[model samples]
Target: MTMRTFASMAKPGVTSALPLKEIPGSYGLPLVDSLVDRFDYFVTEGAENFFKTRIQKYKSTVLRVNMPPGPPIVSDPRVIMLLDAKTFPTLFDLTKVDKRDVLTGAYMPSTDFTGGYRTAVYQDPSEKTHGKLKAFCFEVLKMSRPRIFPEFTKAFDELSVEVEKEFENEGKASFSDKVDDLIFNFLCRALIGADPVAPGPASLGNSGPTHLKTWLAPQLAPIASSGILPKVLDELTIHTITLPFALVSRDYKKLYDFVDTRGSALLDVAQNEMGLQRDEACHDLLFHIGFNAFGGMFILFPSIVKYIAKAGQDLQREIAKEVRGAVEANGGLNMKALESMPLLRSVVYEVLRMDPPVPLQYARARKDFMVESYDAQYEIKEGELLGGYQPLATKDSHVFANAEEFVPGRFLGEEGEKLLEYVLWSNGRETDESTVDNKQCAGKDIVPMVARLLVAHLFLRYDSFAVDESSSSAIFTQLTKAS
Candidate 1:
């Protein structure tokens, strides 16, 4: 019989604390909690495994999945495998069923299956149906300052002003606490939008955000100091804590009921004030994006920030060199920024190499087909796609030098064509990659442009100093300092 150990699922008005089986693959057992601990490792390693599994089985079937956080959901590799197999016209078939995953909480596959299923499909992002797969960069980035990035930066600036004023009297720990407060508000305001089209759950009217924030603050407190918690926990606590918010806000039944009553006008009010365009984007994409982006940026940004702060010897020079050269002195950064800044470009390349945000991309088998059929005359018909990460084409040692180091200038010498072509999305032919492997994050092509510009401004305008001898030591000390 199926076992039950720690089956935890969250849905509106319902909390799934059902005990799940302790087995390795069972849903919601504590082991699954490892998703929080080794997120990158799991995605990268798991993708490779899935790829190898399908290629071995010579099987084909659409496998639906539901991993949390809306993290890199569309990056599933089955789609890539299908496109790859299509070239052979006989290797296999792949289909990506972009289903509504988040609201449901559990992935009920198109069919309930038995052993060795293609299970990498996941991500419950709320978009205009599969739009998250397409729209994250363009819809979010072009918005004016103080919406996503600008808005958060503004909140941080206000918080920075307050922190600076208080620094005259506050202690070091106090300064840290204030900074955390700023981060909290910055996160909320950035994700929720400035206006109230910003529908959240029953805001507790009087004490929800505060109470939740207050309740959540301690979770990170130890992370800042005692250092007992691992790196992943410290970084991901907010996203995990915000799950309850999802449980509340997704309650359209209750929300619509309220709209039917007195809150009906809120729709128009929110639409106008929040600048929400039905044709543009949705609150779910905006909010959930915080979840996806926070993980991606924090995974690498803190380290980058520390590098900048501590590299006092050459910080300004490096910034000006990469930015002025890549963004300004050159043409300008639009999508093409994905090339240029070979040094900064390698930064992204190496980070993705070392830590793929989510190794798997979501897709399923549309039909069965064969692999090596020319020799054995056998088949892997319909649904099976290769089960694995495409590190072959992505982080291929031949394509990338050192393939191991975080060398900032690794991509510098390649000509624009070679550098642009080296990226996983642009370099490989079909049957050679996983789904999301072919693309970086949405707007990935342009992300480096924005980041380089932002970092350039910070380095040029602000004289940043190391908070301590080594930024890593600072990270270690922060484990115990924030509280």
Candidate 2:
């Protein structure tokens, strides 16, 4: 719908002139209300449901919500939750807002921690530095696709074997841990051009793919907790504790040293050709590939597997048939073969629609702007934190039919292609081209390719697998072998 159309649907009660602080919302108890309620909302209903609850209560798409303050967060009071699709696109338009200032906030990581904010994710599109970094990343990622397919194929092959062994041994296989390790290794290999596992003395304590998880846990713990104490600790310890460990810890040091030693030609190009300092180039690479791409897969892969398992036999069969046809048509399991599987691609899109791993996109208004919802327009002040809770927008009833259900072929045809704009979980709209100027994921195409490959490989290896989601972790059981 157009802006004017959405503005006309604006509800009558909440006016644009109302002071943002006075905006109706459950501010909760003195100190802990927002925190307690937020925790409860996520714990009981999941992160996707958190915005739905607020939208229902506030009766407006935009609401002032309290969130723990950190980097990319200016002041807690400025945080605004957006629950509609119409204005969500504004978040990615870098010209409308300054991503660097908004994301950096009060805590710019010391050069020792991240080498500096030269990474594309943190840089404003207008900056020459952003263009250099973005171009370098895109070039590296594009060239790495050939490497990515085979690496992912091998990883998933090993994972299938691991799952089969687990199920045979214990009658059930919890694939989450294995999925995490597999993606971590795949991403490291794709980005750094080396296995993540440390060698020799560095391998003594923390040797394998699990090293990223171990090294990141303590550092991310505070940020995840999200409160005054955690924020304070994060600021104090990021440089002192996190940076030092990132440099010296066996697991982390290997990655750091790899960039330093030109483990990948990308690293060499970034440092020598681009004229970026070694540490700066290393930090940028780590942030773009490690923090953004690897971190995304860490969550995305397992979620895809979970949904595919839950989809049951009929859907699995359809996927398998499509994948098999594509593989045969292409004569191999290459990029063309993977891209040719329409049903597999649809399933990935549907999974992303139902449960996007990264559900929220945050931005700060460089100037005052009016954002319209289905029923009303709200004035967002300069420097105010704007968050688009993507799960809500992607599933808006007006946009998708049977929005809550997992329609496997939802995006398979022409009508389905029209719904692409609603799927904004990848930091940019599906219609938007990935570019250095916008926040669109540089690995947008690659991420889905990886998901499609996972599905293809799983079905190729087994006829179908059943999921036991009765417990906290999903266990894929009843592996019917392909004849």
Which candidate should be chosen as best, given lDDT against the real structure? Answer: 2
Q: Write the per-residue lDDT of candidate 1 for residues 132-234, one digit (tens) a residue.
A: 3334333434342335445545645654466445544443213333433333344444433332223554332222224433322332232132244554664
- TM-score for predicted model 2 compared with the true structure: 0.84
- For model 1, where is the 10-residue window of minimal lDDT? 111-120
Candidate 2 error regions (>4 Å): 1-23, 26-46, 69-77, 101-112, 116-118, 197-208, 223-250, 262-264
Model 1 local distance difference test score? 0.36
lDDT of each: 0.36, 0.68
Task: Compute the lDDT of residue 125 as modeled in candidate 2.
Answer: 82
Q: Give the runs in model 1 whose Cα sits over 4 Å from its true position.
A: 1-128, 131-283, 306-316, 320-349, 359-362, 369-381, 384-393, 413-417, 421-441, 462-483
Error of 2 at 181 (Å): 2.9
Tens digits of per-residue lDDT, candidate 2, 205-256, equal 2244455555555544423532335443443443224334444366656556
TM-score of each model, paired residue for residue: 0.47, 0.84
lDDT of 2: 0.68
